[model samples]
Target: MRHGPATRRGRPAVSGRIVLRLDRMMVERGRSLGWLARQVGITDANLSKIKNNHVSAIRFSTLAAICEALDCQPGDVLVYEADDGDDGTGPRP
Candidate 1:
């Protein structure tokens, strides 16, 4: 049977990647978006958007306030993952 879309049979592609562990970080810090919003005086919805990585841009002051309140560095909020293309088996690579 024909499998799903073939991936050029071994060719690899490079793409920029972004990793977000904000949810985990918030849990570890014993803080919620609401609390953070109150602390930073930003809307909870805004914080949620950032937590879900749906935010397109964020002000430096807001980021700085979050970092200060959470006592964590930017690295803790964002992670980097290399782009490894599918090996033609499945999406998991």
Candidate 2:
């Protein structure tokens, strides 16, 4: 079967990286994880994972909720940092 490009470790390689700034936003907003969790209608554990960048993906609904609760834009929470090796060529090998 055909498979996607992967790294030496056999994990899929991505061109750019998304950095989560949720923890920073939370601090700036002076909101606790539990408080934000309640406002976002999500469990603290899940929110914590997002804050710690331990999650691979986040639902739009959840992102919207977080933005709403934090009173900030999505850009304020997620920042994209392009991989130095990815010069718009293709996936890294």
Candidate 3:
């Protein structure tokens, strides 16, 4: 029997992608990157990475901080896209 791709722990790989809308939320809230970083208790450079979706992972505490600062829910910032055979590098509509 053949097995599907496994993660480091041997569990089957999970598909789909998480898209960060940090920039959008920031604009909607009219808050600058530096201000958000300070409110979230993180560095401006680190926040920029998240805003640009350059990071592979994020901590729950950080997520909570962002949500609190932006007055939004987790779903508002982190959007999950199903794996539909299209490359995720394209800009969102």
List lDDT for all candidates, in order: 0.75, 0.88, 0.91
lDDT, candidate 3, residue 72? 99
Q: Which parts of model 1 are misplaced by more than 4 Å?
A: 1-14, 85-93
TM-scores of the candidates in the order shown: 0.67, 0.74, 0.79
Residue 19, model 2: lDDT of: 79
**What is the model-wide C-alpha lDDT for candidate 3?**
0.91
Displacement of the residue 91 alpha carbon in candidate 1, Å: 22
Evaluated with lDDT, which candidate comes out highest?
Answer: 3
TM-score of candidate 2 relative to the true fold: 0.74
* Alpha-carbon RMSD to native, per candidate: 9.1, 6.3, 4.6
Write out the backbone clash pairs for model 1: none
lDDT of 1: 0.75
lDDT of 2 by residue, 1-93 (tens): 438889998888877988788998999999999999999998999999999999999999999999999899998888876777333335556
- Show where candidate 3 strays beyond 4 Å: 1-4, 85-93
Error of 1 at 75 (Å): 0.7
Model 1 lDDT at residue 91: 46
- Per-prediction count of colliding residue pairs? 0, 0, 0
